[model samples]
Target: MENKSKPKYKLILDAAVEVIAENGYHHSQVSKIAKKAGVADGTIYLYFKNKEDILVSLFEEKMGQFVSKIKDEIEQIDEADQKLYKLIEMHFQQLSEDPDLAIVTQLELRQSNKRLRLKINEVLKGYLTLMDDILHEGMKDGTFQDQLNVKLVRQVLFGTLDEVVTNWVMKEQRYNLVKQAKEVHYLIYNGLRKHN
Candidate 1:
């Protein structure tokens, strides 16, 4: 594998996001990605084994940065509720800022085969675990309901954000996605709060 720390690796990955977003996963070719990256086609092979590897690596690299940023932002907040709100807000904000990435992640990547899907899921675990950490913190601090099921709540929370973003992408992003973060946070926060 090529050294991931190299600038060319990131170039190819970013280019893959663009190519795949425009041409789709099945139609996106290494040559196209390489051209978009301004690298020779052989350069991609040095970094990735195949097109499938590129897709998986793209998800891993991007999602790693995604989760890391969210984690860093949320770590400064003392309240779990605010942390969760930041999570939702950042999720919408990041995707909204990069329409190509939103299209690649929310649409193109989903079209991959089952094996690739599973690999993508593996990369998602870090983000899911971050959510779980927030949920557990809320429960421990008496913010969220004590009876909350962490796993199920995590799934619901992820699904809510995922579906909302997917819908926004599907709708051609005519509306501002980040604008909905407040209501989404409100609904989720109210649902998870401890009852009086």
Candidate 2:
């Protein structure tokens, strides 16, 4: 009788996160990941075509859910402020909920080589476009300041959230990230909202 091969892609990814987190991206090896996954070295190649595929798949699987949740929140809310607040809250909440993903994204993933970095950037653009829509809606409704640069403001907003989450993750996940949502939103809104 032939033995069936289990689906090990997810196992490999979870193992990859631990390996990458412990060793850093440059130092992580496929053999190490396979061993951690409890599979033979060649098994990883069957699931992921290569190392880059693994990284990109990991980003897509993780961030895809993130983008979808935020998109759903955006659909339910009418006010831009509410949407922005929800975005920050959910963003921090997700990171806090999954420390492994936080470590992978905040630490190991950024260590990808230049070409892979560009690919990761491409995946990130989809998330940023969601932010851009919120900014655009705010401007259209006269809620946001007229002089705000849409693209730059989006960068600042994402950058701030990114830094906040990274700090919380790197600090041994001791911080209350979701609780800071209001303050972070207030800081961003104070800069972008129109003066009365």
Candidate 3:
């Protein structure tokens, strides 16, 4: 198994986030990240194939943490609506709490090459799968219309959240991103609700 929490790996991951966040993805160098992590430059190659690999791994590691958190949080809630609200809240709160992460994810990640984008997308399937679970649950319980297109709804839900976060990142995060969680939940709820 890949040991993400090993001290050196964790240090390299954290240092990569800081380095990429401060320098932007293109300007970020492996040597700089190694220097920040107090490791030899070759240490990065041991964990990742290249700079692109580091960026992809950073996203995988960060998003994987949030996905795990969301899964744990969602498991406690019975209602699909409640689960969706928690999801939105956690999504916003995580990015809001870490401004550097917000920059790295929303801004720097978008500037990556095509191969990197695909790799990131592959890692993102887990988050999308989680969203699909909520949509399926809603339909099962009659909270959402049975005839609703789950794939499209997934896009709407994911796209709406992505757009909102991107806008916040672009504005330099001057306002509360997490504060929009409730309203975002409401809007998405209305869109998927059977009775709406």
Clashing pairs in 2: none
TM-score winner between 1 and 3, please give it: 1
- lDDT of prediction 1: 0.95
Instruction: Give the Cα lDDT of each candidate.
Output: 0.95, 0.86, 0.91
Candidate 2 — worst ten consecutive residues by lDDT sum? Answer: 1-10
Q: Please, what is the TM-score per model?
A: 0.98, 0.90, 0.95
List the candidate 2 regions with Cα displacement exceeding 4 Å. Answer: 1-7
Give residue 181's lDDT in candidate 2 (0 to 100).
Answer: 99
- For model 1, name the residue pairs that clash: none
Look at candidate 3 and tell me the lDDT of residue 114.
Answer: 88
How do the residues 91-186 of candidate 1 rate in per-residue lDDT, one tens digit apiece? 999999999999999998888899999999999999999999999999999999999999999999999999999999999999999999999999
Give the Å error, residue 66, model 2.
1.2
Q: Would you list the rank order by lDDT, best first?
A: 1, 3, 2
Per-prediction count of colliding residue pairs?
0, 0, 0
Q: What lDDT tens digits, residue by residue, belong to model 2 across residues 106-180?
A: 988877788998988988988999999999999999899877889999999999999998999878989788999
Candidate 3, position 141, lDDT: 94
**Stretches of model 1 off by over 4 angstroms after superposition:** none
